[model samples]
Target: MLPAAAGYDRGITVFSPDGRLYQVEYAIETVRRGTLALGIKSTDGVILAVEEKTRKLQISNVTQKIFQIDDHIGLAAAGYIPDARTQVDHARFFAQSNRLIYDEVVDVEGVAKNLADMAQQYTQYAGARPFGVALILAGVDKNGIGLYLTDPSGTYIGYDAVAIGAGSEQVTEHLEKNYRNDISLDKACVLAIESIFMVSEEKTGTKHIRLAVIDSKSKTLRMMPLEEIENYSKQVQDKESQS
Candidate 1:
C-alpha cells in the first residue's frame, strides 16, 4: 500500500490530500537536524548566538552559522548552511541597492519580507527545492530592535526571543522563562549563552559558541570576542549556582 504523502513528497509544487506540502515539511526537518541557533531582542539592542562543533585542529575562530547582512543587521542560521550563504549574498546585494537608491538604510522588516517572499517563490515553482535553512534575523533600525524568524515553508514571524535547530524546543522553553524585555544588552548576551549551553554538548567553554550583537546606540553589527564570551560564560555559571 502507498503512504499518504507518497506522490506529494516528490514535488515542491504538489500538495498532499491533507493540504500539506511534503517537500516543504522535509525542508523544515532539515532545519531540525542542524546545530542550535538563537536570537534575543533586549532594551539596549539584539543578540544572536549559535553553537558550532569543530575538530581540534580546526582554526575555530571563523563562525560558520552567523552572518552580517549589513552594518546594522545580523543573521544566525540553522540548517543547510550553503543555502544560508546564498541567501546572505542575495540579501547583501539587496541591502546595498536599497542604500544606493533610497540614500537610507533598509528597514529590518523589509529584508525579512524580501527573503520570505523569495522562499515562497520556490514553493510555487518546479525544478528547485525549497531552501533547507531557517534564519533568525536581528537588527537595530529606526524602529528600534527587530528580530524575526524565517523558515523553509515561506513563513516569517516576529519574536522577542527565538531558537532554531537541534534541541531548540528545550532551549526555547528556557528562553521563555529567562528572557526579559527590559533585559540589558549584557544580560541578553548572558541569556543567549545560557540558552545555548543548556543544549550544547561542549558545556564548559566558550569555544563552541559564536556570538554577535547589534546595539541600539551604535545601530551596527559586531562579533563578540572570545574574551567577552568567556566572561559571559562565567556569569551563566554564577547565576546557576545562586538559583
Candidate 2:
C-alpha cells in the first residue's frame, strides 16, 4: 500500500478522454516541514505588507530562501524556516511550471490555494511532525487585489490583507481593532508596519525586520525602504514613550 512497499507491484496508468495515461508520484521523499501562523484581509486594493522575522542577531537569514517569486506577491513567514522555504519553493515552482496557463502571470490567490493544497498533500505523503509552515501571500491574483494565508497542513484562504510570523496572535489583535472593510492601501500599510512593530516589541530578542509588498494591479514587489522603517521605528518609540 502506502510507504510500506518499495517498488510498485504493477505499473499504474490512467486514461484520459482519448485513452492517455497520467503518471504522478512514483515514490515519496521523507523529511517533514513546519507550520506558520498567517493572517490576511482584502479591504483596499492598493497595498499589503509582509513582515518577516528571524533573529535580531541571527547569524543565518530567516528569509534567506524565500524571495519575491513574482510581481505583486510577497511572502512573510514565521516558525520552521526550512519547512516554510520548501513549501514556498514548491508553490513558486508549480506556478512557474504553468506560467503559460496564466498568461505569464500567476494569480496570487491561486498560488495561495495551491500552497494550502501542498500542506495536505505533504501530510498524506509524509507523516506529520514539528515541521509545519504558515504563509501570508499578499497581492492581486487573477481576481483582484487580495491576500491569502496558508498552513503546513495544506489549507489556504483568500483575504483582503494579511500577516504571518512569531507575533501573529498579538498582531491579529492589533488588526481587529485597526482593520476595516474600507481600509485603503496607505492605511493598510501603516497597520501592517505598526502591527509588526507591536508584535516584535513583545519579543525581547528581535530587532531588524524584513518587509515587502505587492501593489494592487501590478505584479511587482517593493520592499519597504530602510528610511521608512526608521520613520516607523521613531513613531513606535514615540507612542511607547507616550504610554
Candidate 3:
C-alpha cells in the first residue's frame, strides 16, 4: 500500500507537487488487480481475448469483458466491471448517433476519443472520481483494422498489440517475442488465447476464455464460440509440442 501523500490524493481534482493526479494513479491500481484482457492486431484482422472469473459457484460463468459496440467495432475491458459497462453503453450511443447523423459508421479512433474525453472530465471535475478500468477498442474501418488502448486518465493510443490488468508484464513479453505484422487472423486468435493462459493464476480452459475478432474480409465483429476456442487451444498445444 502506498502511503497517503497528505492532502494530495484525498481529492480527485488535486494534483501533487510533481503534477501527478494521485487519485488517477490509485484508479489505475484497481485495473491492475482485475483479470487480464489483451488485443493483437494482425494483417488480416484484430483479435481480443479476456479472462473470465466467477466469484460464486451459483453464478453464471459467461464473461462480460468483450462487447460489440457496432457491427464493426468491439471492446475488451479490464478493471471495474460496472465502470466498463458504462463506457460500453457510451460507445454504443456514439456509434448509433454517428450512423444516424452521418450515414456512416463511427471510426475506431472517434469512439475511443469520445470516451476518453468523457473519462478526462471525471479527473478535472470536483467530487468525481476517475474510472477504475482500462479498455482495448478494436475495429475495422476505412483505413483497415485498428487497435486502441485507453486508461482511466483519459489517455488513449493505438497499438499493434497490448495487454492490461494482472500479469500484463508476462503477457506483454510473450507478445513482443511472437507478434508479427503479417500474422493471420487465425494465428492471432491462437496467440491471444495462449498468452492469456500463460498469465492467468487460475486454470483456464475454452469455457473460461472469451474471444472477439474483426477482419477485413468479414468487415464484421464476432465472438468465437466455445467449441472454436477449444479447437484453437488444441492447435496451440500441438504447435508447442512440435517445437
Candidate 4:
C-alpha cells in the first residue's frame, strides 16, 4: 500500500512531498460511491444516462442525476447530490452570463473549462474543499456533438464515451467493445442504458434510470421520457435473453 501523504492528507490546500493532494483523492473516492453516470457521443448527437437511487420511501421517482445547464448543454453527476447541485448552479450561471455578454450560447467545451477552473479553485483555497463529484457533461455546439468528464480535482477531458461512479471499470470495458465512431443517437442511447445496467448494483428498471440527449440536427437538449426509457429497458433485456 502507498503511504499517506504526510501533511496534505489533512487539507485540500496542502500538497504532499510527492506532489499529491490527498484531500482531492479522498473527495474522488466519495464520488466512486455514487450511482453510475455515463455518456456517449455519436454521429447524430450525444446521450447521458444515470442510475437513480430512491433513498426514501416517500421521495419522488424522478431522477435528480441529470440536469440542464443550458438549451444546448446537459450534465449528469456522480457523487454527493449537494455538491453536484452547487456545481450545476455554477455552470448555469456561467453559461447564461456568456450568452448575455456575447449574444451566443456558451460552447460545450467552454462550459466544461469554466466549471473545471472553478472546481480547481476550491482545492487551492485554505478554507474550501474540493467537490465530491465527477461530472459527465454532454451538448451540441457549432463544433457539433461533444462529451466531457470533469473530476473533483477540476481536471476535465473530452471523450467519445465514458463512465463514472461504482462499477465504472466494467462499464468502460463494455463501452470499448460496443462503442462505434459512427453510432447513431438511438444506438448510443441503447448503449448508455446497457452500460448503466452493467454497472448498477441495485436492480435498475426504467423508473430508476434517467437520460438526456442532445440532438445535433435539432440543436436541442431534452430528457428522455420515462415511458421511452422503459421501452428501451425492455428491448435491452430481450436482446440479452436472445444472446
Candidate 5:
C-alpha cells in the first residue's frame, strides 16, 4: 500500500495533511548528510570552519565550502555544494548592490535574512525545489560581531557558536558547554579545530580543514593559511594532553 505522504512528496507547493512540507524536510535532510561546518563569534571576530574530504590526487588548497560574501561577511556551508555556490553568488550580488545603493557595507544579519527569504520562496513555488543546504554566516560590522544560521526551511537565527551537518548535535552540545561570550579570537580558532576533530574523519591533519576569519580590528575577510591552522591544531593537542 502507498503511504499518505507519497502524493505530497512529489510537489514543493503541496503540504501533507499534517501541515508538513515533505520536500522542504527532504532538502534539510540533505544538509544533515553533509560534512561538518561551524562558525564561532568571539569578542574580537568571527571564525568560519569546515571539514572537506579530498581525493588523494586532487588539489587540496582550494576550499570547497567556505565563501567570502563581502569585505566583512563570510560563510561556511553544508550540503549540496552546487547549491551553496548558487546561494553564495546571490549573496555577493546582494552585498554589492547594498554597497552601491547605501554606500555602506551590508550587515551580517541583512545577508542572512536575504538568503533565508530566497530559500523560502522555493518552497511555495510549484516547479522549484528547496535549496539542499544550510549556511553558517558570520562577520563583523558596525554593530560588532554577528553569527547566524540559515537552513533550507528559509529560517534564519542568530547564535554565538553553532555547527551543522553530520554529528552537529554532539558538536553543538560541546560548543554550548564551553562557549563564552568573552572568548578571545585565538582561543576560538583552537576551539573550532577541537570541535571538528571530535567528529571529522581526518583527525590529525590540517589538510582537510578550511578556515576564514573576519576580525573586528580589520573588518575584512581573510582565509587562514595551512601554516596558521597547523599552529592552532597544536594548541588543541596541547590542551588535550593537559586534561
Candidate 6:
C-alpha cells in the first residue's frame, strides 16, 4: 500500500502495509528545541539569538536544539517543535547526501525548497485545522545572505528578515520601521529580542525566545542568550529616554 521509496529518508527500507513507527528523541540531550524565535543579520557580521527557557518554560522538559542544517544556514521557529525538527532532519540528510555526490555543502536554496515541500506534506496528515509549524530560515547561500519564513501548510515568504510565533505581529511591526537595507549585527541583535518582548508583554503568556543570524562573511550561525537579550531590552529604554 506504500511506495517502495516512501519515507526513505527516515530509514524505511521495506514497504509495510501500515505506516512505520517514528522514534522521537528526548529534549534534554538536544541543543534547543520547542517554542522559540529567531533573527538573522547580514551587516558587517552575523548573529543568532534564542531563549533558553524553551516554550515559556511551562513544560518541565524542552530541547534546546538550534536547528542548523548546514554551517551556512540556520533555523528558528515555533509550533510543534518536533515537527520542525523533522523538517530539519530531512534537510540534513539531503545536505549530507548531496555532499557525497557534489562534494559541497549542497545548495541552500534547494534544501530550503525541499523543506517547503515537506511542510505541506506535514499539514496534510492532520484531519482538520492541520498539524502546523512555522520557520524563520536564514543563511548564506550561493547568492549570499538569504532569509525566509516558511509555514507548515507548504507556503513560504522570502524576506531580508522575518519573525515567527507568539510575537510575530509585534516583531513584524518593529521590522517595518527599523529594518533598513543593511544594519550592524549588534543593532539587529537588540532589535530582535525587543520585538519578541513587545508581543510577550501584550499576550502576558509568552516566555521563551530564540534568535539566529547568518554572517555574510564566514557563513556562520550565532545563537544568543536570554540574559543578553534582557540587557538589550534595558538599553532600549535608555535610548528611548534620550530620544
TM-score, cand. 5: 0.98
Candidate 6: worst 10 consecutive residues by lDDT?
A: 23-32
Winner of 2 and 4 under lDDT: 4
Off by over 4 Å in 2: 1-62, 126-131, 201-207, 237-243
Question: Who is ahead in lDDT, 3 or 4?
Answer: 3
Sequence-dependent TM-score of model 6: 0.70
TM-score, every prediction: 0.98, 0.68, 0.95, 0.95, 0.98, 0.70
Q: What are the per-residue Cα lDDT tens digits for candidate 1 across 1-243? A: 259977778888888899999889889999999999999998989999999989989997789999999999999999999999999998899999999999999889989989998888988899999999999999998887899999998899999999999999999898889887799989999998998888888779899999999989999999999999999999999999999
Error of 3 at 204 (Å): 5.5
Tell me which of candidates 4 and 6 scores higher on lDDT: 4
lDDT of 3: 0.90
RMSD (CA, Å), candidate 1 to true, equals 1.1
RMSD to true structure for each model, in Å = 1.1, 8.9, 1.6, 1.6, 1.1, 9.4
Candidate 4 wrongly placed segments (more than 4 Å): 1-3
- Which residue pairs in candidate 3 have backbone atoms (N, alpha carbon, C) closer than 3 angstroms, thus clashing? none
Number of colliding residue pairs in each model: 0, 25, 0, 0, 0, 18
Model 6 regions more than 4 Å off: 1-36, 45-65, 123-131, 202-209, 225-231
Please report, in order, the local distance difference test score of every candidate based on alpha carbons.
0.92, 0.55, 0.90, 0.87, 0.94, 0.59
Q: Order of candidates by lDDT, top first?
A: 5, 1, 3, 4, 6, 2
- Which residue pairs show backbone clashes in model 4? none
- C-alpha positional error of residue 117 in candidate 3 after TM-score superposition, expressed in Å: 0.8
Which number leads on lDDT?
5
